[model samples]
Target: MMKKYTIENNYIKLVTIDYGAAIHQLITKDKNGNDVNVVISFEDLESYKHNPTYLGASVGRFAGRINKDGYTINGKHYSVYTKNDVHLHGGKEGFSFKTWKMESISEGENPSIKFSYSSNDMEEGYPGNLQVSVTYTIVENQLSIVFDATTDQDTIVNLTNHNYYNLSGEGSILDHELLINAESILTKDSDAIPTGKYTSVANTYFDFREKREIGSTYEFKGIDDTYVLKENNPLATIYSKKTGIEMVVTSNQPGVVIYTPETMDENKISNKPLGKYPSICFETEKFSDGPNQKDFPSTLLKKGDIYKNETYLTFNIK
Candidate 1:
């Protein structure tokens, strides 16, 4: 059965549902004291059930793409489900399609909710029985997401929330200012798989070291690149002059995928006719295709070991 949960603090409100452990809505106040939903969402549970765009879902067993042939661990190769020659977002029916169990909920100064799921052995061509949990917490103007998991056997894992943001609460994100604390990004092949190469962002269209309008770059094809994050505390920052809202992202992960799709299914969006470049997703997680790239950080999680990734999003008017 599908269930919804809501938790909020003085400065922000968060609503989530057990279906996919997805975020339904996140609301913050603008400079004019108006409520603004920075992320896109659907109108009903049916739309979420067929969430083709991923929307505000928590994605996993692996968050990014994997080569179609799959990866080898402990000298044994494991094949995964794929489409169009790419194993994406943890196969066809990944965590985003599952109904997670609500483990707990707390309401106080810092309200929070915890959801858990158990993946059976070999489900979706993955090895081992994995146990996972995602916790969402709100304190003041900040929201924190914590992902924890453990597997019975050695396996790969990369989890992240797929929340498309439009700080203005409507229209495209072309005018939003973005800044990424990274010097290089992973180069990809035609199939969107990392090519084991790091390209410098200096003087390039991918450069976001300085806060600048997303559309300032001419002929912007849209960003679907993974940035190798520096040791900076906040990995990225986004601001919208239209609403005077700023979002600061900080994560313990080593990489982040900034995705700005050229278009979306407007019919699925609630009370809005969103068009091209409507929102941007900051997927804070390990490098894409890390399992296939020898130089990239490993996504291997051994038995008896715990895998943890924590990311914080702080919002304010500036």
Candidate 2:
């Protein structure tokens, strides 16, 4: 059995497991003071092992795809695993599939847990002996996830948490309202790889400069795009009418990848039988294919440099 841990405060409760350092549950109070499990989760570790949708796990060594199935580091070409002709979310064996060491667990004003992992040089077709640590902390009504990493050799890295959230806790998120603080999104090819260009969200379905229902426009089947963040401010906000729960997302990352799955059935998440648009993923990280796109912010980490990122998800009642 996989070891699990829990940390709580007056307003929130969080449970996490060592396997993939995945979040098992995040409990928060609703408008009527009822506990709501705002994050999509599984019943067991086995279910997480077979997870294809990356439900609630920390994803890395690169959070998004590396276009053309490979990338170059310091004048050397490196080929990585690809699906549908592009590298997707690290590779076949990503951090989301590995067990991380529980460095520490504590409860106090800031209840928190830290998980650490080391990636060997050339593992998953990437260079550098990279060491990464993810710390999840809860204080008051906020859950903060901090990712820190250092590599022994120059390499590319982008990390983000893959958390599917449904503020209502028990239904589809199609009716939820969303507000993103971005003015543009990375242009993409037919395969969902960034095309080294971007388009303004103004006058487009991509626009979310103001609050709007996720289902307001049916122009696209579902969102799976990265919005270039305008600043290091609160990047997005989500609220649910059924539960009267609100979420404010703040991150220092340059891009936020928003994905609302077209469908969520039993097969997609193992034994978990879920309906269509069950939840939405708000992945804060560097742009997709950032290493290959000269025009985008670089995700390169040097031998001695530290890569640090922080994202905060604060909960409240609308």
Candidate 3:
């Protein structure tokens, strides 16, 4: 039988994976601090094939774009294929788009669904035979994701999830209050690429030093940018000012990419309500090309090495 989990009691419609790292559910709420089912999804395997948005999908091989389709490492330039003039999330056939092998159990401390995959040498222009395992765990109102990866050759990798959250359990997150622990903002050149320079968030749209409404900031017009997370801290949070709901995002990674989904042309995804700024993603990962950038941390691994990345999302309503 396929592996799955349930927390059903007229509150949630929970589904797990015996295939990959995707959780399906409809989260509604009641007065007694309980969440109910409100999001519709396919009850069986057939419906998932067409589900785009990767909706709640586990992404990897690299979670963001690689500018100009390539980067250099150790004085060597490695070229990548251009998708729509730029390299997109793992070159179109990334892990998110694949059906992964899975394993499960019901009575563990924190029940989990593990998805494992391997990328051969030069897959997506990256070098290595990477063995990746993404495990999702839900415990005491918090969802913790642990990513374990090992590569036989040197390669670049970043992984994250694309989960749309509405603390109000409503449409759109424009009215949400977000606080990013950032002192200076990353200055980007054209094409939204980081310029390897920084600017103070003070007196600018990038400032989130205080708890401010996200939409209240004018620079939030659907532009996706990266922020080098403030050091000395392990987590950042966003709380809904109206519903009193809070989401804390914690990661061990060095940077976070805040993507206001409105940046994508709606038509590009077809006529669906899914294409707007209804959500924001705080993707935690290493700096893009950190291996090549003289100032950024090096992302290199030789054989017999182990690498790990972790992120946590905790939710509560006040």
Candidate 4:
């Protein structure tokens, strides 16, 4: 069973559920004054229980992959759950797969909903009694997400929301135009884990410094890369020519992972399979494998210290 909490303003209507604290609906009007749900979601809670795609769920402990040999804290190496070698999005049973407690819900002005969860030490091979909270606040045409956490012991933390967005509310995102305030993207191995190196997007398909259709260069290859953000303005902007709706994304995090799965398997969890390139995820967070990379932004959380991150998704008509 799923419990839903909702908050809306004249410009948007947001509905989120306790299961995975997943966003069930985000109603916003297109340029033509037609309402559309801009995020991908399942109609039933059971689909979320078996969600193959993260959808609009909050991921945690560590937002991206951790190399084969996890990380060391105070010279003590710790092992984490891994697929073949990489430790992915926390683990098999990550935070997105669990139910969160409703901490509070407010329905005026800046309407919002807060959800909390506690992770036990060694759960999924992470070391810490972690307390996590996520707040979703909706205003006129913006949705702000605040992620906060604290641990009882030294641990690594990097949380991010995985929202698959389609500004037009339908069809392949390939038709959308995008702009990323990023000069380069992390170079990755075949497995999609950064190799601690970066490549400039100056003349490559990775470049999004100027607004362009997503299918212009990378076409069928799609993308699953982390971009090193430029100076502190909105990190990225995406627009749909069809609906004339635009989304400006800003975050305090240093990197943003953009992904579009290579294939869309409708047989995974739903009878209706989302076609290829259905949506794209803009995951803002610390650099991937941050705990292991000394040069990347640190993901360390000391005992008694607080961890906080915020991302703003503002909508507009263009």
Candidate 5:
């Protein structure tokens, strides 16, 4: 069974569900003082259950792709669930399809809800019994997601939320201005798997160091690259001139995967069909295929050790 939980402050209203511990809605006032939902979401639980795009779900165990060869720790090789020469987002079922337990909820100036799940040993072909918790807290106009986990055996973890945001609340995101405080991005092969190398964004279309429209580049297709973040506090910012809503994204992770799909299958939001490039996602997590890349930041979670990732999205009316 699935359940929804809501928390609000003076500036925003948020809705979350136990299935996938997903974010269902985030409503904020626009410049016109009218309500708008900044995140793309479905209208019912049935649609979410078939969420091929991941939607506002929490993806985990390993958030991104791992080479089809799998990974090793302490000289022991482990095979993971994979398809088409890659292991993605834990596995076919992954954390996004799990039903988490609602642990707690609170109401106040800063309301919050916590959801937990325990992954069994070798579930999805990953070793160890892992205990994971995701807490969503609303403080004023900002929403903070904190992911914490512990494994009873040596395992790997990279958890993150997959929320598609459209600050204007409707239409394509090409008109949105974007900025990312990063100088380089992970180089990937034809299969979209990182090749353990970094490419400078200078003199390239991948550069977002300065605020600019996402469609400024010629023949703009879409973005699905991982950016190596700098030490800047706020990792990225995006704004919609139409609604005068701006979002500042901050996180403690080493990198962020920015994805802008060219099109989505027929999915409805607010009784309207979601069209092409309706939103963008900033997935803050450790480097992709970290366990396989020796130089990338490790995603290894040793026994008895805790793993934590925190990300914040602060909204304001510009």
Candidate 6:
């Protein structure tokens, strides 16, 4: 018996888990008053198990990269689990793949599902017995995600939900326009690890200071740049010139990694016309590669401290 929470408003609907994957689908009318499933989903556990890219899964333990999978914490060196010669998204078997304990915070009227998990000391090669909770709520046209955590020992923690979206609920989003309210970005090496340099978004393809078509320069390869946002405001807009719909992202996280399905090789559910580049992901969270880089923001959770973060995705039309 898998758990699913279905939420809707006048123009759209978002579905998530009584577990973790945020299978958000925008249910809207297509020219006619005909309702269609414009969103994508693996929906079942079997698909999520085989899809190494996480499909529409949440990212955690750590959401991005760590240098050499080795780093020092409080004058002591800790070697985290490795991937591509580095540590990516926690480690080998991070929390995203696990089933969280779920509880309904309210019985009716915009209810939310709370997911809690505990990571014991040195679990996945990191320190601390961290207890974390993430709540998902849908009210009006907004899908809000709230994350909280507490730990008994010092350890690095970064969490973010990875959901791909296409505002028009249409075909490839390569022509969709985007605007990021960021002034700078953390530079990275070819392997996508930060080079310890924070540079301006000026005159570079890194600039999304204004609306730009995702396809205009997409041939230069996909963007996974970590933008140093204006504030803890992790909001950006994607407007589908094809449909008049716009999707807005708001978060307390300091950075966002906007990515298209440039690396997608997964199957789309039949009856839907989805190409490889249909959707885009807005991964909102703390700076990437923090554990190894002293210059990056610290993600250490002190003993008895509360970690709280909020990210909301709202929808509307132009």
lDDT of each: 0.90, 0.87, 0.64, 0.86, 0.90, 0.72
Q: Residue by residue across 76-147, what tens digits does model 3's lDDT show?
A: 678876665666567767776676676444434455556778778888788889998877666656666778
Per-residue lDDT tens digits for candidate 1, residues 6-122, read 999879999999988999899999999999988988878667889867888989899999998989998999999889989999899999999999999999999999999999988
Tell me how far candidate 1 lies from the true structure as C-alpha RMSD in angstroms: 1.1
- In terms of lDDT, the best-performing candidate is 1
> TM-score, each model?
0.97, 0.95, 0.82, 0.95, 0.97, 0.89
Could you tell me which residue pairs clash in candidate 6?
none
Question: Candidates ranked by TM-score, best first?
Answer: 1, 5, 2, 4, 6, 3
lDDT of each residue in 42-124, candidate 4, tens digit only: 76667778875787898988899998887899888998888888999988899999999999998888899999999999888
> Candidate 3 regions off by >4 Å?
1-20, 26-32, 36-53, 74-76, 217-219, 231-234, 263-276
RMSD per candidate (Å) reads 1.1, 1.8, 4.1, 1.8, 1.2, 2.5
Off by over 4 Å in 2: 217-220, 266-275
Candidate 5, residues 80-158: lDDT per residue as tens digits?
A: 8778888888899999999999999999999999999999999887899999999999998899999999999999999
Model 2: per-residue Cα lDDT over 238-265, one tens digit each: 9999889999999989999999887665
**Model 4: runs farther than 4 Å from truth?**
217-220, 265-275
Task: Report how far off residue 133 is in candidate 1 (Å).
Answer: 0.3
Residue pairs with colliding backbones in model 1 are: none
lDDT for 272 in candidate 3 is 34
Ranking by lDDT: 1, 5, 2, 4, 6, 3
Cand. 1 Cα-lDDT: 0.90
lDDT of 6 by residue, 1-318 (tens): 456666665655656664444454546544444565545566454666555666566677888888774777888888877867878887887877776777555534575667788888998888889898888776766678888889898888898887767655656777788888999988888778888888898877667778898777635366677888885443688777666666777888888887765645445442246655777778888887887677767888888988877898776656
- Which pairs clash in model 5? none
